[model samples]
Target: MTEIPAVENAITIRDLVVDYGTRRILDGINLDIPAGQIMVIMGGSGAGKSTLLRCILGLKKPTSGSINILGTEVNGVRARDMHALRKQMGVAFQGGALFSSMSVAENIQLPLREHTRLDETTIEIMTRIKLDMVNMLPHEHLMPAELSGGMTKRTALARAIIMDPKLLFFDEPSSGLDPSTSAELDELIIMLKNSMRMTIIVITHELDSVFKIADHIAVIGEGRILETGTPEQIRASTNLEVQDLLHRKARETVVDADAHLRRLVGEEE
Candidate 1:
């Protein structure tokens, strides 16, 4: 009998917590994303999904817990070490976050130019290659203002992959797009995972895209991880919060009467 190989994690998060003033954003998050796979972190609005992403990216300092990305501990990592770690990671923000002033090619080439000492011709060639990979080669000279929503997304994706990052993080990738465009982006994400062999972490609430692209799904609610599993497992989850999120049903607010009264009387500050 042949034995299966052990899976390697591209990221490991343990007891992750984040807070703003007195509001605890993330309670305790423990997650592991396997190498060369797509993991989708999903939740409703204010569920701490974005906060978790920020912590993993080393953008926001967590109140406690550990975040290890690409085998390097992110918490309390030195500035220069964190900078080095970022070279192995790529992020596509919710709004594409492309500069309105730069053309598509220039936007895609920005990372290489900033991080490397490659010649101008080499940078141009690399930029075109990335643009071609995202099917935006023909629009390389087009500025961000001239691009449509789908085009803007593709350009951002092109830029994200320019450095061939080991890990790719996409925030709300399917947001604000028509169904067709969103589906196209979904396909592109899978293709990137297959072709680049990079671990991809997507933060989204779009059920369709989540099911389509995720190898694993972590459902979060009220600053807690409600469940984590494959799409089928998630669909079959018994947890009410997970089911509500999956079925698009509104969650009932369970108000604590005493706490509510205390806050109303300014006694629980």
Candidate 2:
């Protein structure tokens, strides 16, 4: 990442609200991610976790609120400024998102090629270093389809950090892997944080992965943050919804017959 003034928090979000047409997704969210810490955002399906990630990633605009990433407000930053700021960040998308046509080395080199004016030799050296970091150097010549799921994830991780991004984002890093593979990936995540000192934001609901890597965890539900704390605090939380989620218990929704009918008729607000 580019040299910038140091700050206590890498990301600060306040009164963030996002809506899609008539339905609200994120309602009144406030969060501060401390610098160089691993913050995990976990939630059940349709819990607005992904929506909030989008807002922070600058992929979508919110209905109302402010998002400060790396001390720069993202809502209306100048185009050039935003470009510069984004150079400090990187995202490892879900399912790897590697181009099927590109080799692993090529994929990792994409960012450097797009962002910098380095020569081919330096870019090649950088790409190889990243691949070695992720234990993917041996497979650098393979295409996306030729690699296993774990290999794919490792390659994506290498690409995310190839630029030495100040803030790194991971989406479902352990999603499709087996137990042992997941554990290995979790270890790599911690090792990277320790070695690189990059502030990482992981969006995942996997409990084992969460316990292993997260410095702090935020539980989101129903388009809002339900709780934010250390893993132990989250485990000890007294909130009914939190407990339900932690135990993987099915939510019991009591019926309001009249209100239900009204909602079905588009009458409930």
TM-score of each: 0.91, 0.89
Write model 1 residue lDDT over 123-213, tens digit each, in one string: 8988888888878999999999999988988888888888999999999988889989999899999999999999999999988888899
Looking at candidate 1, what is the lDDT of residue 187?
A: 94
Question: In candidate 2, what are the lDDT values of residues 104-127, reduced to their tens digit?
Answer: 999999999999999999999999
Whose TM-score is greatest here? 1
The candidate scoring highest on lDDT is 1
Q: Clashing residue pairs, candidate 2?
A: none
Model 2, residue 99: C-alpha shift (Å): 1.1
- How displaced is residue 2 in candidate 2, in Å? 32
Evaluate model 1: give its lDDT.
0.91
TM match of model 2 to true structure = 0.89
lDDT of 2: 0.90
